[model samples]
Target: MSALAEKADSPLKKKPPSWSDIWLKNTKPLKHVVFTMPLQSLSPKDPKSQTLIPTFANIDRTLLLSDELLLQILPKLPHLQRNPNSLVCKRWLNLQGRLIRSLKILDWDFLESGRLFTRFPNLTHVDLLNGCLLSPRDSGILLTHRLVSMQMGSGFCSNRKFLEEDLLPVEVVDKGLQALANGCPNLRRLVVINASELGLLTVAEECLTLQELELHKCNDNVLRGIAACENLQIVKLVANVDGLYSSSVTDIGLTILAQGCKRLVRLELSGCEGSFDGIKAIGQCCLMLEELTICDHKMDDGWLAGLSYCENLKTLKLLSCKRIDRSPGRDEYLGFCPALERLHLQKCQLRSKKSVRALFRVCEAVREIVIQDCWGLDNDMFRFASVCRRVKLLSLEGCSLLTTEGLEAVILSWQDLENLIVVSCKNINESGISPALATLFSILKELRWRPDVKSLLASSLVGTGMGKKGGRFFKRT
Candidate 1:
């Protein structure tokens, strides 16, 4: 053997250090070494400058090889262009489709041509707001069953042909709506405003899976077609008819709808001239009704009293429905619905405080009460809040008669008030709200008021207005 080979094979006189001893000696420099290599490699490499290639070239290859890691890092990269991450690679283009579930086609020309749905096959929900759904030249695009919910404007399926003078041709409206209804088989919810007679008929016959339907400015034909939906749970109708014309909806249309929909839970009728007989029909027929909103010109105390028989009603909203001046008989009849939880009466001239008190006494489970623009609600009605302790939210906006004393009395009675809004109330000053604030300070989550610093000091009793230097208000930051 040569001299170098003999020296390498010879055993050491002193004991050599183990792996742990070597690791302990190199630990401090390892962080600096590991960090500097990446920094040096990240600098721009120039082949003409004779810069040597990194020994860790394989490490860079290993880090960039993972598709999952690339996907996770692409979103974090800063760019000056529009969605540069989307333009990164084909993998990102595939991910964009999975992120979108609902698509609303607003462009009239694009929707009328039916090219949008063809591109996005995964779309299950579609909204055609102020746009027409055009008929397909080929049957393949119309027969793709994907859409489940749709909302459109009125005249969506009318058959009238367009003339040269018309901007929006009649052919577009007829073909678009017909194609949409016939295409989307799984559709369950349909909302249409200003619907034509033919459009109403088409939706009722074609949309078998529809559960909720809303009709605005509709005629008797629409109401009759809505009655045909067996699975309908909610139906809202806003009638727009001339004063000279009227429909059978006051009695016959309502009767047919109530009998047809056994599962009906919510029904809203606004701007309709329905009589007391119509109200009576609803109470008797809609046994499963949970919510009812009625707004009309002639709704009086007698019409409201007729709703007492509706035992399952939990929510009722009556707008501009006044009580008759001499309808003393209907006062006692108001205390019928015991299961009601929410009641909203706006612009209603409630006759007396006794009538308001009678309502609370009957609906003992009421949690929310809103009375806006109401005349004749005196101090006596404010006292009723004390008796009904279950109220969680209360709003009295534009009730000009509600004084500070009246507000204090109501607040003193409430033990579990969470939200209280008193707007446009001129009489409810800081002094009137101080006591209620003290009682509800800990429990109250939201309180809205517009008061000056002097009023705040007066209400807080920090500046001798109420003869106290400091109180709970000082500690409530």
Candidate 2:
């Protein structure tokens, strides 16, 4: 044993005390004394003691985050709720001003109060569907210099209480819209549905910066008001008035619009009740028209024949146009649309095979065709697809006379075809589908048909032989 160990253990010879004894002897004040007598080490046997130790007051306060950092961390937080920054702390309140540049509150009563709008001054685009009681003055207040686009719902004009009590007659609605237009000088697009004629005129006059205007369920006076927009590029007119009768936008109104909007490229006219004269006027005035859609109106082959004059026309959609009879001269009219790329004919009663052949012959550049619920289409029409070299997508749904043989002929001829949809055609079966599938399996991306479960499973498991992977084949239920 060393000298230190021997002194710690010795009981005589003035042995130096151990470290623990020295500490006790050196201490001056002692509150209590404890004796360490040998005993069994006892501890509780509870299972929780072996589990995780419980802790209190473990909150960490050193990580203080700033609002700017929080906003940078989460930019899409405002889209989750209406005025989300308002609910956050005052530090986040300023974020609402920066984020709410485009506000679209549709039919939510909570947003009806103008308080939300007043809170954010940077709003540039707003769409109010319903729930707000906006007076003419209130509407003007909402239109600021920053606002560039605004869409007010039909409810604004249709409210019974506003019409009877609050509204300032038709003249007042016009003045309000005009005021809004004048306020937002940068306004580019405006859509007001179910408003009065005077209100429409107010919009045309005040919103001079408008490039596109859509007015539905209006009157002839409103159509006349559209003449004020000299720079308008696109116009949509939907008339629905009771007891107020007017000529179906005769040449007089159309001539005025065409002459005014020289830069017009696209025009959509539905439920106009106009004759071929209006269409002729469009053809004569708007020679630069690229896309035109005329639905639920009366138009004969003469009107279509006039459309051939529109050299720039690329897309033409005629829905429920029953006046276009399938006559021998129909092909001559179809020859006019040379630049046509897409043609949509729905429930038009197109029966003649020559008409179909003429359509394909005239519109040689057609890449897509949709013929739904058209009557009198037979094998001859199906055979016409063989000549359509550019056809990529074809939809023939509800064409009862179309059979698998016709589809097979069309599919086999289409080398560049990508998509083919035949819905509710009872005559089409797997035999006709399989041949085309084998030929264009590589290029084909989508095939929709109603086939048996076994055939569908087999087609899915065993691909068609086109030197490429097979595409998806959906079985209609």
Candidate 3:
């Protein structure tokens, strides 16, 4: 075939795809893709070929790093590391949330419901402020709180006080529980105030590892919910929601709790009444019960009989406990807790020698003693404290009946006393501060009776006001 004729007959070849087309297919924004030459070079007739197109000179530095690398680096960098593109990528933002092992979310308005677990995955402990948790494991967060109390009788009508404490910033409804159940799979410890039965049940069902729980004014449903927590070791039942009526927790709920939570080791009941049955149930079932703290409630003097059953009980703390039996020679009926080791009484009524002896009758293994605001207790009560050879630490605060001579008598007899704290003891005046007491103070590891100790002994008369203020520190070594 002739060359000219053959060329005319041949089909035209297709142009290979250009860099713009290839790069544009893979890149996020086509505007970011640039070429060395202007488009006019390909089409000679274009009028604007002489003009130059300026490209963006700088690229975002973060965009250069791979998503995996960014995830590892983001947590190490401070929160405000780079403000420009903090959460440019969707996946990276989600990953950043998982790095948070501990968090306190004061604002529910900001949190998206049902995403709590995805937001914080490694959190082992959670505290709800009218809030709830999603799943995280292995990592734990610590929360320290004061033993905030109200003046002894100030809260008798202190319904207003309860409003501030037990009420949630926002009520936890069904949707909230549904979100929590789906999200918090590894929750180990939780403290939620005023949570309803459904919410409580959902947590027990979903958070299988839950060991510690604190709730206000529990009922049957709440107990049913907690019954499901097979690993529960610590429980604090708050009964002082002044505005709210005491529920079935006092007796029925307590019985169920004792029957259900057999693994319990520490239990605290505040502002609770009608205690013998409940206390007996706990002692009978929770053999592992080690520490029991009861405050601002009446358990009848007979409640001590039930507590005698807790063979493994180690520590007993009674604050403002009522029903003192000053009847003489009832020491036999005073009850005995052989395993008892540490005793702490604050603002309790120890009006008679029998009352004081009855309370201490069970403190056989007593090593540490803290007596505060027990005005009725005089030199006679100190005699009971003197007998415990295992006693190492002693703290006396607001004991108006205690004089310098009584302290001397007791301190001299205590064979193993290591630390002593006397604050606000009215009767122990300047004349009472003998050279011997000063010499004794010098030998101890912790001696807290300062020279200016101005008799806080009247704290009870001034009233145990509500809130965290107006209390002396009791350091446990």
Best by lDDT: 3
TM-scores for all candidates: the values are: 0.58, 0.61, 0.67
Kindly indicate the candidate among 1 and 3 with the higher lDDT: 3
Which stretches of model 2 miss by more than 4 angstroms? Answer: 1-78, 88-169, 194-198, 240-247, 320-330, 346-362, 372-387, 398-400, 413-418, 432-463, 466-477
What ranking of all candidate models by TM-score puts the best one first? 3, 2, 1
Residue-wise C-alpha lDDT for candidate 1, range 1-477, written one tens digit per residue: 698787777786447889989988898798799999998987657654433455554344634556566545554556443255556456555444333345665555664576654444444455553343333333332222111122322343344321111223434544555655665544566554444556655755776777777655455555666767788888876663233123334555566677777678898876655555666677787788899887653343445466676788999887665552224244455655767789787887766665566655555567888888887766766676566678887888877766877777777677777777666666666665564455464356655543222444354433322232322122211
lDDT of 3 at 13: 41
The superposed Cα distance between candidate 1 and the true structure at residue 336, in angstroms, equals 2.8
How does residue 170 of candidate 2 score in lDDT?
A: 51
Which residue window of length 10 is worst by lDDT in model 1?
Answer: 141-150
List clashing residue pairs in candidate 1. 133-176, 154-194
Positional deviation of 163 in candidate 1, in angstroms?
A: 20
Considering summed lDDT, which 10 consecutive residues are worst modelled in model 2?
143-152
Q: What is the lDDT of residue 399 in candidate 3?
A: 88
Clashing pairs in 3: 121-136, 135-183, 135-184, 151-464, 424-456
Best by TM-score: 3
Better of 2 and 3 by lDDT: 3
Give the poorly placed runs of model 1, Cα more than 4 Å off: 1-129, 132-175, 196-198, 241-249, 283-288, 295-301, 319-329, 345-364, 372-389, 411-419, 433-477
